[model samples]
Target: MGSGEHDRILDAALAEADTAGLRGKAVTPFLLGRIVELSGGRSLEVNLDLARNNVRVAAEVAIAWAARR
Candidate 1:
């Protein structure tokens, strides 16, 4: 994704987190995981590191086709 697209994706994900009433690491992980999941299938991952806080969060997502609900 380009910088602008990446930014929007992040923004939407953050907004999703806000809607879910979550913040910080929790939100970051869920957002990244969904983005990765949307991008592909079997194996997808996103890593976020907070340099100032020296914390890293990584998520791996896998998707399978769903039969009718």
Candidate 2:
């Protein structure tokens, strides 16, 4: 990619980081969508992050449910 393309991508990422909402401590989906768009449609990294976080949250929920049972 040319310097122009790189600069544009960087600019887009910075723009996204600007508007991203903090959900407790992490960036929201809307912002992540912008990032994935800017990242040449590479979303697997984001998917992995979401999946990992989901797994942890699910495990916590399951533990809580078991405790209540």
Candidate 3:
């Protein structure tokens, strides 16, 4: 929720985007792990379905940009 946490999530998401190739379900677990680390071991509540969808879209966009380079 802080800037540092947000940056960490973005970094992880991008990494997962490049490596996982838009598979949201596959990527969600990794994202959740990163979130936990960023949150200092505290459990966080998130809408899994929405998170997966967002990650899928983000990964697709990232892939598209990568393809251009």
TM-score of each: 0.48, 0.41, 0.36
lDDT of 2 by residue, 1-69 (tens): 456765676677666666664354354565556656776665556578889999999999999999998
Residue-wise C-alpha lDDT for candidate 3, range 21-53, written one tens digit per residue: 757576767777766665665435444566888
lDDT, each prediction: 0.56, 0.68, 0.71
How high a TM-score does candidate 3 get?
0.36
Question: Following a full C-alpha superposition, what root-mean-square deviation does model 2 have from the true structure?
Answer: 8.4
Question: Which regions of candidate 3 are displaced past 4 Å?
Answer: 20-22, 42-69
Clash numbers, per candidate: 0, 0, 0
Off by over 4 Å in 2: 1-42
Error of 3 at 35 (Å): 1.7
Instruction: State which candidate, 2 or 3, has the greater lDDT.
Output: 3
Residue pairs in candidate 3 whose N, alpha carbon or C atoms collide under 3 angstroms: none
Candidate 2 pairs with clashing backbones: none
